[model samples]
Target chain A: SAVISQKPSRDICQRGTSLTIQCQVDSQVTMMFWYRQQPGQSLTLIATANQGSEATYESGFVIDKFPISRPNLTFSTLTVSNMSPEDSSIYLCSVAGTSRVSNEQFFGPGTRLTVL
Target chain B: QQQVKQSPQSLIVQKGGISIINCAYENTAFDYFPWYQQFPGKGPALLIAIRPDVSEKKEGRFTISFNKSAKQFSLHIMDSQPGDSATYFCAASTGLGANNLFFGTGTRLTVIP
Candidate 1:
């Protein structure tokens, strides 16, 4: 399985501020996805961070709110811009491939964000 | 709309008993169904998965039973243990451009000794 790590394992941000979360994988991957897990809620797909193109946001998510950058195949970042109280959630980064024990995707530990 | 519905918001099972979690999907385009296990302060890990081509798939103590015609699938955990207590999620995804998985609400499983 790929070894994935995220910076700022946990953070407390004030409303109207922006916090960027970085995801780094030990090896190159073809697909990297960002997900959000709200308090006591299921995991929600935020966007698909493409290596060279604009990130593809989900239906209820917008690029302005969650901008993503994937400079290389092994690294990506998600910036929660203009954060709000409702934006408090655990943000996770995942990679898709066959390198893992399972055919499914492998995820990072996750970045815990709490907006006050 | 692609939505995977899961059942049993919470469950309590005794150790050495069987724990079952069911999930249903409305979209037939979903060809891949995967179950994930998540512990507190951790990301969800892929537990097991099954495809439409097979009716059931088993991995050690965990099994995934799929009903293609019914668009429903269930996870069975045998010989449940205290260490198996965690929140489980069922997700479905299509083989479209990108693998965008739609997840269910999740079921909190508590295995008591």
Candidate 2:
């Protein structure tokens, strides 16, 4: 298993403001993904951060609203642009194939965002 | 369309009892099914997973039973404890690493002493 950490554990931002959440893994990883968990809801995949390439945004999500950057292995960032009250949710980062205990993805602590 | 479906939004099980959560999928292409546990203020943690080729997989007190023909699976938590109280989610993906996973609504399990 790998140790993953996210910056700004919790934050409150006003509408129209943007916040970039950073995810850093203790070791190099091949694939990194961003997910969102709405209040009292299950997680939803936001995008896949690819190294040296444009992130793959999932259906119902666009790059204009959520932009991702993966400069290299072990690190990635997701910026929630034009934040709105509906954007308030827990943003999580997960990595795959990094000492996977049982071929499962390891997740970060997640950044709790509250858009006011 | 909802790729995966989970049952029993909430459950209450007594200590030392069996806790079962069921999940069904609509896509047969999904070969990987993983169960995640989430605390109140934390990210979902991968608990256990099973592949379609296997009928069951067990690790410690957690077990995953898969029925490929029926397109269904379930998680069985034995010897439940209060510490097991958390939101559990069932997710499925066709591929690993870079593939996106479809998640269920989640089940809140409360193990009472």
lDDT of 2 by residue, A1-116 (tens): 78999999999999999999999999999889999999998889999999999999998999999999999998999999999999999999999877543347878999999999
TM-score of 2: 0.97
Best by TM-score: 2
lDDT of 1 by residue, A2-83 (tens): 8899998999999999999999999988889999999999989999999999999988999999999999999999999999
DockQ for each model: 0.59, 0.62
Model 2 RMSD in angstroms? 1.3
DockQ-derived CAPRI band for the predicted complex in model 2: medium
Clashing residue pairs found in predicted model 1: none
